[model samples]
Target: MIDLFKFFGKEESKSKDIAKERLKLVLIHDRANISPKFLDMIKDDIIKVISNYMEIEEAGLDIRLSRIPQEDDTYSTALVANIPIRRVKNMGPNRG
Candidate 1:
């Protein structure tokens, strides 16, 4: 089975991928200067607001702050949210 899987192609090592993800999260939090509790609060609020407009895949929602480098070597923090929408709400006059 391992040989068969390798026959198709080999992917990045899981451990390395995990390490990279952990480093990214540490950097994001450090640059954003936010605590885990605060992050959770923000995530919850986002879910609430978005769910009001559309059905969302809450379990798959990914919210993070990323540092983007600028031309002058300065960095800007960006709010990155990946929310999968299932369907839009039909609120008629009050639709979002």
Candidate 2:
């Protein structure tokens, strides 16, 4: 049972979590002014391009674009993606 006496623990609270989460999100949004809808569009474009040339495992794909808070608490957003593809099976003239 949670101790009511320790209600004000030194741990992060739900409100704090919301603030931090919103802060990071707002920072990213404000820096680029890119809507979530636009982000989805970009993701689709990236997936299309990468899919055309390789049999990549979609679950392994990682794509993130965000800004880092600098000294002035202002920063630029950066796009980062990781697409891993396994080696092709066989294409040695069928060993003929």
Candidate 3:
């Protein structure tokens, strides 16, 4: 027999996860004060810059704008980039 409670619980969990992700996107967009296209460009540039020194898990990379509370009761936008490093790259002496 199929367990209705378990099935509903799993569905509810999935819905909650989706809702949370949507809310995060909305918050980031509102707080960043930047267009989505610009954000994508920034994200790509960040990935490229980091990739020069180390290999990063592109799929695991999370770049978002967050609101940080300040002592003056004001909020500031911060760029948070969570780059998962797969391995460090070895860069030899630069011959310029």
Instruction: Output the lDDT of residue 57, model 1.
Output: 93
lDDT of 1: 0.84
Q: Residue 87, candidate 1: how far off, in angstroms?
A: 0.6
- Give TM-scores for every candidate, taking all chains together and pairing residue i with residue i: 0.76, 0.57, 0.72
Looking at model 1, residue 46 earns an lDDT score of 91
Regions of model 2 farther than 4 Å from truth: 1-22, 68-74, 87-96
lDDT of 3 by residue, 1-96 (tens): 999999999999999999998887777787666877888999999998888889999999998877788999988888888999999887878821
Residue 40 lDDT, candidate 2, scale 0-100: 73
| lDDT agreement of model 2 with the native | 0.74
TM-score of 3: 0.72
- lDDT per residue for candidate 1 within 1-96, as digits (tens), equals 368676544454666688898898888888789877898899999999888889999888998878888999998888889999999988898553
Best by lDDT: 3
Q: State the lDDT of candidate 2 residue by residue for 1-96, as single tens digits.
A: 988756865355867888997788777866788787887788889988767656677788876677766898867688778878864435367552
Q: Model 3 off-target regions past 4 Å?
A: 1-21, 94-96
Rank ordering of all candidates by TM-score, starting from the highest: 1, 3, 2
Question: What TM-score does candidate 1 reach?
Answer: 0.76
Candidate 1 vs candidate 2: the TM-score winner is: 1
Residue 42 in model 2: shift from native, Å? 0.4
lDDT of residue 17 for candidate 3: 100
